[model samples]
Target: MAKPKAKLETLQDKEILTSELAAIVGKTPQWIRQLTRDKVLNQVSRGKYNLGEAVQAYCEHVSGGKEEEQKPRLIDFKTRYEKTKAEKAELELERIKGNLHAAADVEWLLSDMILTIKTRLLGVPSRVSTECENESADVVESVVRREIETALSAMAKYTPDQIGGDVSHGGPEDS
Candidate 1:
């Protein structure tokens, strides 16, 4: 006479230790414990798991089962936030180094420069009119040329120290 073996029932009928489950899942026992703590895996008893349920839960977790964020995802979010913060700090440093200027300051400077040029040019006709009137054609031409040259000379020189700008901060480059 031979002894008969009892047939296994459901997959949950088999229970395994954490270390054994960790080996089957190809992860460290510590990582298995972490998954247990996160409710991604269940325990059949202390240090043990139902094989079938553990496998099913692990599959759903890996498949991104619409659960809350995991540790890895939280790490990724932190990395992106730090990267953005660092970029903003770099921009602020560049601005402090005077490598950048505000739009309002630039606009005001341009308007002032244009007004100065306009004033100098408009004054030329008035200043030279009397001298030009009583002179010969060549004399009148030279007087007008000298007045225009004076205005152009002023236009060629620019310094940030004038009015609202600070020389130490430097000025905007030519557009």
Candidate 2:
């Protein structure tokens, strides 16, 4: 017995399967599936796409043109993203460590400076008494107060940063 021939339908706007479209476009079925998933090719129905529209969309995509709804590529954060996050965290830790070291050095400098100032202040009256050996107690008191005020005023004129350098920036030699 002879098999009957398949009838050819003359539908104008016929839709085709992704595999059929892929064959027509000379591309793989996977490529066509990707295009559909990317929304580059408009699917008319589930697992079916308008052949004419798909061809037009594919041509536009190939020519660097986009449709009304531009699909953004989804980013996967499990690979390079995790590595970048770790790098940023390490850089932040190093920066914090450097700042801590700078803070410690500044604290040491400030304490040393304060100790020197206090020593000078404590010795001021004795030094003044030697300068005015024969002066009255009242005279000595007045001179000490005036000298202390003048020294404090001079010290007040300098800012903390200005007073903070040691041998490196030519301020004072650190022992």
Best by lDDT: 1
- Residues 52-162 of candidate 2: C-alpha lDDT, one tens digit per residue: 788888888775565335553223334467889999888778656653234555666666557656876888877897877888989888889877886676557545454
In the predicted model 2, the residue pairs found to clash are none
Question: For candidate 2, what is the TM-score?
Answer: 0.35
In the range 31-106, model 1's lDDT, one tens digit per residue, is 9999999998989789999998898888777765544644345445667899999999998897677766567666
lDDT of each: 0.77, 0.71
Q: Estimate candidate 2's alpha-carbon lDDT, on a 0 to 1 scale.
A: 0.71
* lDDT value, residue 108 of candidate 2: 62
Q: What TM-score should be assigned to candidate 1?
A: 0.47
